[model samples]
Target chain A: MTDEQRLYSIWVYLQAEPLFWLTLTIGAYLVGDFCYRRSNLFPLFNPVALSIIIVSGVLLIFDIQYERYFEGAKFIHFLLGPATVSLAIPIYQKWALIKSNAMPIISAVLLGSVFAILITYLLALAFSLEREIVLSLLPRSVTAPIAMGISELIGGIPSLTAIITIITGIIGAAFGTFTLDLLRVKKMSARGFGIGLASHGIGTARAMSRDKTAGVFAAVAMGLSGVVTALIVPLIIFLLKI
Target chain B: MLESIFLIFLFQLVGEMIQKFFELTIPGPVIGLVLLLVALLLFGKYSTSVKTRLEKGLTTTAEYLLGHLPLLFVPIGVGVVMHISFLENRLLAVLFVIFSATVLSIGFTAFVMEKLQNLGNQNDG
Candidate 1:
C-alpha cells in the first residue's frame, strides 16, 4: 500500500478509540516535560502550555473536532479537582509562615483581587468591548472552577471565561517572573503572591518551579485570591453599579 | 500511597458535601483544604505518632500530585480550542486587556504587599 493509505489506516484505528486523547494528553505532557528539562527548565517551557499546543496541533492536523478529542481528555480534566485539593499540602507545610503573615497575606490578596478587577474593568471599557466580554473578563484572574461559577452569576459566558482565565494564566506565568524581576520586587512571598494573584493556577505552577518558599506563598496567594475574588467581585460590582 | 490518596479524596468528599449543603460558590477543593488543615492542626496538637504517619502519608501524596500540577491543567488549556470561533472577533482586544490587567495586578499586588509587610516589620521592631 502507498504511504497515503498507510497514514489513513493508522488514523482510522487510533481515532476510533476513546483512549486516544488521554494517551495524547499524557504523551504530550511527557514530551513537554522532556523539552522543559532539556531547556534547563526555561520559564516559558510550561508543561501545560506546551502540551496544549502539541495536543491541539495534533487534533487540528488530524481534522478532529474538539468535542471528539475531549472524550478522552476529560479524564485529565477531572483530575483538576484532586490536584486543586492537593494544594493543601504546600499550604500545610508552610502553615507556620502563613499564620505569622496572616494579616498581610489577607490584606494583600484582597487588594490584589480588587486591583485585578479594577484594571480589567478599565481596560475593557476603554476598548468598548461587549458587555458579555467585559463580564467574562472580570473573572479572568480567578481560578477556573470559581470563575466559571461567577461567570454565570454575572451574565458572562463560562466557557469564554475559562478561555480567558487560562490565557491569563499562561501569559502571567510566562511574563510574571520577568516582570517582577524588572520591577526589582525582591520579596519572595511577594513575588509568589503577585504571580498567583494575577494568573491563578498557571502562575502558581510557574512559581512552584522556582523555589519552595515561592511555591508555598504562591499556593496561599492563589487560594486566597480565589476566595477574595469570589466574594468581593459582586460586592464591588454592586457598590459601583458597574 | 493508597492510604494518602484515600485521605485526599476523603477531604474532597467532605468538601463536596459542605458545598452542596451550603450552596457555596467556593470550590469544593478549597473547602476540602480547610477541613484538611483543621484535621492536621488537631492531630498535630493532640497526637504525635498517628499524626506523624497520617501527615507523612498525606503530605507525600499531596506533594506528588501537586508536583505535576501543571499536567492537570492541560485539558482545560486545550479546551480553549473549543472557543476560538466565539473569541475570533474580539481576540485582539481580549488579549490586550488581559495582558495589561495581568501585569498591572501583579505589580500592584507586589507593591502593596511589600509596603504592608514592611509596616508590620516596623511595628514589631
Candidate 2:
C-alpha cells in the first residue's frame, strides 16, 4: 500500500485498538538494547540510538503517521514519570551514602546548573542571536519534556527546546565520561553526580552501565537537578529581569 | 517483584497526591522517590528476598528501557521536517546553542564536581 493508505489503515485500527504503538515501542526498545549490549559500539549502537533508527524505519515502511504512533507510545512516555520516581528505591537503599555525599551533590548541582545556563547564554549572545531565542535555548540541558515547558514559560519556542534537549543528552552521553576521566575523577559518586546533573536521563543511563554506585548517585543528581533547575532557572530569569 | 510493584504503586499514588495538592511541578517519580527513601530509612533493614526480586525486575526493566530510550525521540525528529521553516531561519543559532551547551554541560559538570570533591577532602584533612 502507499504510505498514505497505510497510515490511514493504521489510524482506523488505532481508533478501535490502541495498544499497537506501545507494543512496537517496547519491542523496538528491547531489540535495540540487546544489540547494543552485544555490539558494544559506544556511540553508534546505543539502544536509544538504534531504537530511533529502527522504529523510524518501521513507521515509514508501515506508512504510519507520528500522531498515530504517539497515541499508543504515550504509554511508554507516561511510565517515564514513574520510572524516574522508581529510582527512589535504589536511592533509598543508598540513603546513608547519599547523606554523606549530600554536600557534594548539592554543590555540584548548583555549580552545574549555573554553568549550563551561563555558558548557553554566553555562547548564544556571542553568536549574535536575539533575546527570546537565547532564552529558548536556556533549558536545553534539562530533559526534553521539561525543557519544552520551561521554554514556553520563558517565551521561547517549544520545538527548538526539544531539539536542544536531545542534542544535549546525546553529547553528554558520548563525551561526559571521557572528560570525567581526563580530569582524573576517581570516585564513582562524583562521576555519577556530574553525569546526572548535566545529562539528566541519558546521563543517568550511562552512569548505570558503569556500576550500581554510579547509577544510584546519577539518579540522585538527576532528580535533584531537575527540581533545582525548574525552580532556579526561572528565578534567575526573573531576577535578571530578562 | 510483587513487593516492588506494590511499593512502586504506593509511591506513585503519593506522588500524585503531592502533585495535585501542592501543584508541584516536580514529576511524580521524584516525589515517590523521596517518599520511598523516607520509608526505607524509617524501616531500616528490609527482608532481602523481596528486595532482591524487586531489584532484579527493576534492573532488567531499567536496562531494557533505558538502552533504547533515545529511539523514542524519532517521532520528534520528524518534527524537524515540519518545522523546516524555523530551522532555516535560526539554523546557526540553534546548532550553536545546542552544540555549545552540550559540551559546556559535560565540561562544567566535571570541573565543578571535581573541585567540590577536592574541597571536601581538604576540609576533612
- Model 1 reproduced share of reference interface contacts: 0.72
Runs in model 2 deviating more than 4 A are A1-23, A34-39, A144-146, A238-241, B45-88, B122-125
* Clash pairs detected, candidate 2: A52-B71, A85-B29
Which tens-of-lDDT digit does each residue in A12-72 have in candidate 1?
8888777878889999999998988898767688677788899989988878888888777
- List per-prediction Cα lDDT, in the order shown: 0.83, 0.70
Worst 10 residues of 2 chain A by lDDT: A41-50
Clashes of 1: 0
Question: Each model's TM-score, in the order given?
Answer: 0.92, 0.80
TM-score of chain A of 2: 0.81
Query: How far in Å is the alpha carbon of B104 misplaced in model 2?
Result: 2.1
> Candidate 2, B111: how far from true, in Å?
3.0
- C-alpha DockQ of every model: 0.60, 0.40
Judging by TM-score against the true structure, name the best candidate.
1
Shift in Å, residue A223, candidate 1: 2.2
